[model samples]
Target: MREHEAQARTPRRDARSAATGQARRGDVSGLHYTPDKARRSANLAAFVQKTRAVDSRGAADLQKLFAEGDFIERIGALVAPHGLRIDNVADAYTMWWITAWHAARGENDDPSPATLTAVRAQAAHAITATGEIARASDAQKQELAEALWVQSALIDVAMEQAKRDPSRLRAVGDAVRQGAKGMGLNLDTIDLTSKGFVPVGVGQNDAPATTPKPGSAAPYGALALAAGGIGVGGFLMLRQRRG
Candidate 1:
């Protein structure tokens, strides 16, 4: 059977589709299923029936996720055999939904209390799912770790306070420094506040590095070239006259 059909019968995930009014459990077919899978399928149907429902974009991403088998299959091929349980997969889906909701709201630094609570819950679930996947192969583990980092960043943005405290700013700076380090770029020696801002390894009085304006060049070089050309032409004319 096809992957989507398999997913519709998979258990926890198909619940979102039904909940979003896309399809009913009875409508899903073309999957060879065991009785246990069938029972979970029905549960998914029911849970989806009463949930808040996902938006259209969320619905589409969920479909893509199902088509890709939640990335676990891809990760499995690169690494040794390991599996993602249904719950962790659902957590990933929930994380996506939360991220979509935040984005739709313009990703404000602070949301309403109720929204904040919901977002925090989603972030926590994502972190938990990442932890569960950490035991998988190195490739799989890295993917999970990146997902956790994304959620953590979202949480930080969502929870920023307006006090504009130095400590919070310092924390953000530290994170930026560390991220640069991860990319093998050391930025510690770059001073942003030095007087005159002479760049390291460059002469203090060196002309500011500006691109040559569209039609400009060093005058002396152009003059020298013109002089040389004239001298050559004059020399040739004299030689011709003499000849």
Candidate 2:
């Protein structure tokens, strides 16, 4: 999966609805904010934009950044001119997703564990390098945790869907919803690029979640890579957990 392709598959909020949509989630966008809050929000957006630009350019060096243990200083420095500061958990949370997708979309990788490792590494750095995670609201904290759980779940379901139809990623949101269904999570809409998510229910089936143990790093949106080493056998192995 190329970076642009991975991005193309990830759902982003419709730009026309960003303000109203993000505002409802109590995110950086609201009717008004303190001057400092507005500044920070702008900086965060700049950081996200700058980093994503690197991926868009088709540069391979992104894997180097993804391999680093701490993003607080590493990524922060890269996007500093663009105004990124590691002062808030929202920034930290957003960076994790960015790096995860970058890493997952890189070459010769398995998507599920790659996403998990990227997220875990970012959380580890956020915990050690800043007080923001500790200071984050309980709701924010839970959102971060659930997002992590959904990381592996997303890949597993996509892989399963790919078995029946390799182009399942073309409809990424729908595929992700099927993954959420197994966990009994009802989603109105789930967008990976968006900062917030709300699962509407546990599940219609009332089935217990059978999360896969994070095994090894991989790529996202690379159903084609399944043929590299994870072919039919690997997909079958995933059934127990993703079912």
Candidate 3:
């Protein structure tokens, strides 16, 4: 996994409520956000809602689907053309569900052959119909982008938490789903291809200003340090023997 540097900017102000001008503070059940963040929050909320809807049996099936050796590579190839990358195993799993949701909602919009092939590979796990990708309204596109961004944010937070304690990954997943349920979005009506249903207080605050690249130096630095230490130690031992 690549090391993602944390953002250096000051946190933006909390989002204002449309009905009330006051800054929406974090509620006991959830976090507050500005309009943009709200959209992301809503996207994540909806994602969690759908995830929660999956039955245990279906989840096991999904686990099996993701376990395929080529699954991650296939997803990478399909999304890379669109300037996206799966950051981790959790991101890959979240993306699988998001991809299925988009396909079901007809949001693919003239998917390339590679995209189609990737989609078909997981067709059996789709909870909804494997609909064709068709052109969507601008609002729909914006919604989809925001949703993807939110998914990335959730994955980032979950990955960070997992670093400290692996069990927190499951807890984070469950919490996100629960948070979305608390936000009151009618998950059944969340159609990414349609417009005009903005869920309040759900914002995209968690996303970093810039997406980090997987080629960052942190991973390589550790290897380099270890190799250099080994070389230095061997040289010191040889010098002492010669003395």
Q: Clash pairs of candidate 1?
A: 19-48
How close to the true structure is residue 65 of candidate 3, measured as C-alpha lDDT? 29
Give per-residue CA lDDT, model 2, range 1-243, as digits (tens).
699876765545455377666544543321111224344333333333333443332112222322233322333443344333344333333333433332233211232434434343343443434444444544444333323322433344344455455344434435334434433333343222221211234323221222211211122223222322333334345543432
Ranking by TM-score: 2, 3, 1
Model 1 C-alpha lDDT per residue in residues 1-243, reported as the tens digit of each score: 699888767676657766755432222210111223344333323222212142333233323322333232222232122221222322332333333233222332323345434433443333333443323333333333333222322223322321256554444444434433443323353221112212346644221121111111111111122112223233234323422
Candidate 2 positional error at 205, Å: 43
Reference-based lDDT, residue 201, model 3: 41
By summed lDDT, which 10 consecutive residues of candidate 1 come out lowest? 214-223
Candidate 1 lDDT at 153 equals 26
Displacement of the residue 3 alpha carbon in candidate 1, Å: 48
Query: Which ten residues in a row are the worst by lDDT in model 3?
Result: 213-222
How good is model 1 by TM-score? 0.19
lDDT of 1: 0.31
Candidate 1 ranges beyond 4 A from true positions: 1-148, 151-155, 185-243
**Mind giving the per-residue lDDT tens digits that candidate 3 earns over 1-243?**
133222222122222233233312211001111224344345434433454354333333323322333332333454565544433222232343343233333232343455434432232122111111112232333344344333433333233324455455445444443333343323333322222112234332121111111111011111122112223233234323422
- Candidate 2 residue pairs in backbone clash: 109-218, 109-219, 110-218, 110-219, 111-218, 111-219, 184-202, 184-203, 186-200
Estimate the lDDT of model 2: 0.35
